[model samples]
Target: MLTPTTASPRLKLATAPLMLLIGGFVSLQSLINGELASRLGTGLRASVAAAVSSFGSGLVLLTLFVLLHPGSRRQVATLGRRLREGTLPPWMVIGGLAGGLFVASQGITTPTLGVALFIVCVVAGQSVMALVVDHRGWGPSGQTAVSAPRLFGAVLAVAAAVLVGLQAGLDPAGAGLGLLLALLPLVAGAGTSVQQGLNGRVAAQVGPWATTWNNFVVGTTGLLVFWLVTFALPGQLTAPPRDWWLYTGGLFGIAFIALSTVMVRIHGVLVLGLWAVAGQVIAAVVIDLVVAPEQLGVLSFVAAGLTLVGVVGAMTLRARGVR
Candidate 1:
């Protein structure tokens, strides 16, 4: 009974909300990863061990999906050809190494730093690098100039991260060092996000399913290699906890990879990344207040509120084409 025009609009209306919902889900899943890392840090396992195991699980899951899904094989082959043709940059593989480092850092430091501080540090690093990445358009998609709105959003996100750090009671000297180390993963994540955005832009040409599978495959392989070289040596890595909850971090990673691809399609990578950071900050605040009241103070809330306002304003400007 529905005409094509009406159906298309209706579909868009339905899909926009769904995309936002998925974004929220991705954020919550990230928070869960933070929690899992904190818990697992108490165990003997190296953070790299958890990261490797999670990536291994994700590789298996994606491989299974590709095998069972009829059209995925063709898509994978086509994507491989595209990569060979140089449509996908070789540097993306480095992004996977970054991912491994991030997981390891989270596992090693999250307990000492707490979720709120960790998220803030990570977001700060990500936003600063994201600005550079987005401005340069260093991914599969051709370059899109960075706009003012995007810059404003990045600043706000950084401010929010700073506020979170201040709440962590870190001495100036120690905070400086922690912030520096945190930037490593943040820069890596920004690269990953750019790649994701580029992938979304080309999704219609190169099947999304195929692209997703290829990323996981490459990322997993890279992480596996890292594990072998750095942590898999005897006495270097600890065994992972046998409990099911420890595995939640890996499950969250799988969900994030898939949902983030969908989000990049609906929201520009910059906006999606900002919102994701916002969500994590919100969760981090709640976690800190409940678990570590010493980290909660007046300045933290004020900075958080200001950062939120800035993010919202930036998003509004973006919607108005003022970016």
Candidate 2:
């Protein structure tokens, strides 16, 4: 039987920090994957290659775990039975396809739109969709009415992302092409809320490990198909470099997804997304400070601060509403 989505206070306290940490992992994964993509090849095809590598490597790792761990194997079997019985919706398993789209969009749009604009568009889509997903009870946590604070948090989260990249300035070189490409990440980001909700539903039935494995399976297959379609495109697939760190993106993704699968069932998608934004902002700031101190700006710190403020405000306000 599935566990209830309502979490105890203790669980809330424990999970919040974990969600933030998982968000940091997400930031790290993006860094690693972007580096990998830049190094492995060029053009959109190379982006697909990096994405495929991330998903495929994660799939292999999860596959090994399923083979070795009896508990995970049983959970997978149980989920299969539930699906066969029609107790679980089959559509939920396809959440990973959204993940595939999200990564692919990063490759397709970032060069044209610039990371600043892309992040803003993506965060905007994610924040808005998260509100709808939570309010409509699409996730395992059930319906959470959209309160003023929650709404504010969503807006603030987007603002924080925008603030972080304020100094970077959006590129206007390919305005027409960038606008079209921008839609890809916008839609893809919205899909992530759906992905989180679906993963939570699946995790409620089986477990996070099994749910994460299932995501990797679907995501890997989708990315593989994407790669094949782009195979004949005009781009060169450079041989994999010997740098070991480039290959760790998938491992980071595995951790992030598994942790998020568990956390989303407790906090709902909006709050979870806010917390994640906070973590990502903080981690990015830290990375900048360490890797290139000269480029770091005061606005980056301010953006990180605003993300935390948004998260805390939302949490406090939502808790009162529940009471």
On TM-score, the leading prediction is 2
Candidate 1 colliding pairs, count:
0
In the range 18-91, model 2's lDDT, one tens digit per residue, is 98898788666666666677787887789989888888898999999999999999999988998999998899
Per-model clash counts, in order, read: 0, 0
Per-residue error for 6 in candidate 2, Å, reads 9.4
Instruction: Give the TM-scores of the predictions, in the order they appear.
Output: 0.77, 0.81
Q: lDDT per residue, candidate 1, 1-323, as tens digits?
A: 33323445455456555444443443443444445554444432445555666666767787898999889888887767776998755554344455555666665555555555565566656666666665677554556677777678668767866665565445665876555544544554455555554555455556777766665666667666665665435334334456776566556666766766655555545666667666766676676677676755675676556556766787788779895
- 99: Cα error in model 1, Å: 3.1
Top candidate when judged by lDDT against the true structure = 2
TM-score of 1: 0.77
Residue 95 of model 1 has an lDDT of 46
| Candidate 2 Cα outliers beyond 4 Å, as residue runs | 1-16, 106-122, 158-170, 176-183, 261-272, 289-309, 319-323
In model 1, the runs with Cα more than 4 Å from the true position are 1-45, 83-89, 92-94, 139-141, 164-177, 180-185, 197-205, 229-239, 267-271, 291-303
Error of 2 at 216 (Å): 0.5
